[model samples]
Target chain A: MTLLTSAVAAIVCTIIWYKNAPKNDMKIGILCWMYWGATIMWFVDAIFEYAELKAEYFSPAPADMLNDFFLGLSVVVFGLIIWLVILLIKDPKGVIKSALSKKAN
Target chain B: MACFLISTAEAVVTTVAAKQIEKNENLREVNVSEVKYSHKTPFSKKLKWLRNMLWGGSALLLFEHVWHGEIVPFFPFLTAASNPADAAEMLHEMATVGVTMALLVTGVWGVIVGITTAMEKKAEKEDAAQIAEHAEN
Candidate 1:
């Protein structure tokens, strides 16, 4: 489920990015990269987990699946936090910079 | 809240930027009404991408959880002790694998954007030079 969750996310984000790709918005592209990166990480994770669990992987206990779901959500939220930091630094629209300059006056 | 204060400050600044762009760009600016809050600069598309990623990732995760019955109202996962299968070990994994994944993603993204932006600027310079040469000829 964890692997699949990240994979699904990567697909969705990729589709959105591609649809408006002509705009090639740097911020959005970065986001697409972030999710694709995560999908890779989770893919490796799932592979190793499958090797260990084999057919057992087909039927995880309900409790374990729930726990994995929460962990997946946690990662998503963490990604958002990181993206926010990037945005702050980039100040793409010069919003934060403009705000700072205004205060100096 | 600190977030609210920061947002307000951002709004004030963006409004000023929008006015400047309006004067200079001849209103070629997109999201004019939102100029004061979050106008689309050359890099703003990435911000849109980020928003979509968060929503899409979140929705997919939720859908998977629901399908697996791991997130049913009947099962209360809020209680950690009730689900020992995902606590200590998961925490360990989160700290190790989770943190590493986040850092790796961020680092890779930073490098990619840096390289691409440089390449883009270089191409633009070449194009301008070609135009000038043609005009001179």
Candidate 2:
């Protein structure tokens, strides 16, 4: 489930990036890279879990699937938070900078 | 703190992006640091909305998880599950609720981007007309 969710997210972000490739915004590219990175991380995790569980991995119990699902969502959410923080720091669009300067004056 | 980490990450991201851009001969000598992203660019405006959507959606989801007792500051929360039936229900909630929230955020961002783009175009045309009128005088 983790693998599937992350892959879906990576694919969605990739498609968006592809459509806007000419513009090539850094923020969008960063987001795409983040999701793809997460997907790879979960892929490796799935491989390890499969190795440990062998056949049982192929038929994960509902509880195991649910756990994996939550884990995947957590990873996705964490990725967004990290991205948001970066966006805030960079103030890529100058929104935060203007807001802060306005508050200062 | 998170501010320090994000500043570090920002350096890494900017370096990577600049390196990628440098591969293009035309932009090879461009100073990435000197190039500040303008607030008025269409991409920037759209990204502003997207940032809001994602941050808001993630916050809402966290609140939901906390309310549902799925999240805790302990290891048990990582493995929370009552039984097979309960797990199935949880899976259903994740699929339905999680997907809906993501979709809602994306949909709103898309719509606002479309509207803003159109409005910007209209404003640009009006400005052009005014310049042409002034030049004729």
Residues A20-95, model 1: lDDT tens digits: 8777534666566556655755554565577889999889999998888776666666656666777789877888
Winning model by TM-score = 1
Question: Which predicted model would earn the best DockQ?
Answer: 1
TM-score of 1: 0.44
Interface quality of candidate 1 as DockQ? 0.09
Q: Estimate, for each residue in A4-95, the C-alpha lDDT of model 2 and write its tens digit.
A: 87678778877988888867534766666556544443354456467778998889889978987887677677766766787778877788
DockQ, every prediction: 0.09, 0.03
TM per candidate: 0.44, 0.44
Model 2: chain A TM-score against the true structure: 0.83
lDDT of 2 by residue, B1-137 (tens): 01111222333554455445446534533646565332244353345445444443343334335644666667545234545766676566445444444444456557767877788778777877887999999
What TM-score between 0 and 1 does chain B of candidate 1 receive? 0.48
Off by over 4 Å in 2: A24-26, B1-137
Cα lDDT, model 1, residue B14: 42
What CAPRI grade goes to candidate 2?
A: incorrect
lDDT of 1 at A94: 88
